[model samples]
Target: MPNLIAATYAPLQSNGTLQLNGIEYYTKYLTHNRIKGVFVNGSTGDFVSLSIQERKELLTAWHQNKPNGFQIINHVGHTSLPLAQELAAHSIGKADAISALAPYYYPITNNNLLIQYCKSIAEAAPELPFYYYHIPVLSKIQIDIVAFMKRAKTEIPNFAGLKFTENNLMGFTHCLHNSTDNQNIMFGVDEMFLPSLGSGAHSWVGSTYNQIAPLYQAIANSFTVGQHQKAASLQQKAIRFVEILVAYGSFLGVAKGLLDYLGLPLGPSRFPHTNLTTNVYSKIMRTLENEGIAPYLGNLP
Candidate 1:
């Protein structure tokens, strides 16, 4: 049951500071959704906008409220190593695992700096399993798969896995071939679940699981438990759902709407993200209705 089904939480905004509801709401959200773990302050959670203290609060809150048997993966990536270290240290005893990304909003050279950067953060939380989050789209930094594995072994001791979000299937094959001691490779995209799992992605963490966790779990079970056909059928349905949701607007807006529709109090995107158009909203709603997932919409406001 340790196989991870993690949710990326959007920190609530309050009076210019990120405010996460205390244990009550956090625990309620996880329990009701049957989530296996939490991935706070990750890309889907809008990690870029949160301050270090706010991120720490979210991590601590999850550690305190998460149901027994549930785990946490603290995402401590930041533009500065110092801040990343602070979050990592704060999560030392609080989270089961910790992950960090290549520093973004700046240019970087080779896999050397990226490896060194992740190594420094992992060192801060030596006892926790560390995962390297590779989201090339946002970070603008790509690590050579082979180079990363070679350096990780020498420099990062507690390195446990990686979140490879790149959609290149060929690239994924190459990375798995480069693993040492069953190093876990988690796929980050929602729509690629089947192919990713088929290609040997042992674990995953993503945003849509907040609302569509059951569907994701079904897809995973189908493949792992001798229902390949069922998994493929469900995978097609899930991908179609993801495509329609994203088509309605920016990924953040659509995801927030889904969270709201599910009666989760995730609120709107903090800022720098725009609202969806009326036509797109109507179209999305129609798609939901057609797909029979409207019952989960509950009492959306």
Candidate 2:
């Protein structure tokens, strides 16, 4: 498991077509900054807004340009089980691992159905490790992950672990400590990452890691050296980064805009997610600088 896996954005052109040519730059930027992997076609990538072919293109682009030592975990979740399976089958040789969110439209409240849904997808790409993307906030299926893990262990042979995205540290802790197998449970809440570290999490996957790998690395280093206050302060800075972006518009949308500063022009976000104008982009940069976060942004291209 990678220490920091960035949930990447889906690059688009002005006309909303896939801007896959930019993946080389994106891959290099993350590698140079020491990011370990990418969680593609996930929420940060605006997967819901993208079509099946578009999603496959994003995964193909990332896989093609993947740097050495960097992993790509493709999220193949869809409301349609058949579509999800199609995606899973497509990712066989392309992705290092595959994950899927619970079906959101009808919502599977029963753990059995959830496991079955996962089982079907896992079977589609029997060669790849499968992770259940447990983001209850979006999926609205608040099933206990610990229970899900127990059932999945018996049923789903290729179940790798979870992309645990909820803020329930208690639940996350239970999943980590009480699992029958050694699960690779990567923490997903970016704002509360410090506490997750304290709870003994080594790996994390989040949108913020795309831009601030150095900052999170600093926090990890500080914690390792017992610099408690320093680590906490750095965590607060991360929280503020999300806060500042959300103030302008959708944090994810604004984050896609920020990637331009690193030299990968990902173009604007899709509908309902705010896209920054040139003036707004400059203003945000100035704000980040004023807020003392510029230095922690790592080496920008």
Candidate 3:
């Protein structure tokens, strides 16, 4: 129950300016729904796209104005150790805890490499709890989860838990069951919430929460209170919206489009990630219009 529901804040723009709504909308979303946390600079937050200074600014604003009682989990993953360390240090006093993925765009060896990398980071900010991020699809280095957990417990005591973003929920569940039950486990996939929770997931980080936080809160609490049917129904709604978005284009573009529709100045995604094409744009607009997702856009801020 420690700020269980979290929104992944994505800040990307062709222009130099960071859209303040990327910050404000989530803060306002949290306030409106009485949700508890805001996760900044994660995969959905587009952490790798922003400069260190931009990441710092977003974190600063969240620290300053996040609704009272809301926890902030800052993702500080970077290819450079120095930069990652500096960002981890910066996030220490600003947020409740922090996270970092296995260094991306590089081939890595065994769990030892990951253990050493995470330990070095854990050593840098001894004051804050550092959650290890596991997104093999993005990082390309799947640290054997069981092996990583074993080493973390013995080597880095400051190593708190994991933000598992892999598509393999069953495998992740096996890892969870095989490891220490006390270690906190947060699910990364938005669509797999119910199964993950049923499998004993404790926390979650999702991009869709940025848009439909109240609905997620309802689903999460519904599960907690033994309302599995209701939780599934709510989660179904979330999945439906996500399907529509993906059918239009990439998840990132759809998320950005949602933000844009909300009146936020969050511009288009970076190159190699083009905006929706004409036909796709029309389909997205039509889907949004049909779904009444516009009302939720207004609810964001």
Estimated TM-score for each candidate: 0.87, 0.97, 0.85
Model 2 TM: 0.97
Greater-lDDT candidate between 1 and 2: 2
Candidate 1 residues lying further than 4 Å off, grouped into runs, are 13-17, 224-229, 275-283, 292-301
**Local accuracy by lDDT, each model:** 0.74, 0.89, 0.74
Location of the lowest summed lDDT over 10 successive residues in candidate 1: 292-301
Regions of candidate 2 where Cα sits further than 4 Å from its true position: 180-182
lDDT of 3: 0.74
**What's the CA error at residue 206 for candidate 1, in Å?**
1.0
Model 1, 193-291: lDDT tens per residue?
888877887767777766666777777877888899988887777777777777766777676655654456555676675455446666777887798
Candidate 2, residue 97: CA error in Å?
Answer: 0.6
lDDT of 3 by residue, 1-301 (tens): 3244555545555563676555665577556655668778877767777889989988998887776777888888789988888898898779888888888777666887888888887777887878898888888885678778877888987777888888897778877776665577778888887778788777787777666666666777899999999889877777877888877567776766666655555677764444754466666667766875534333544
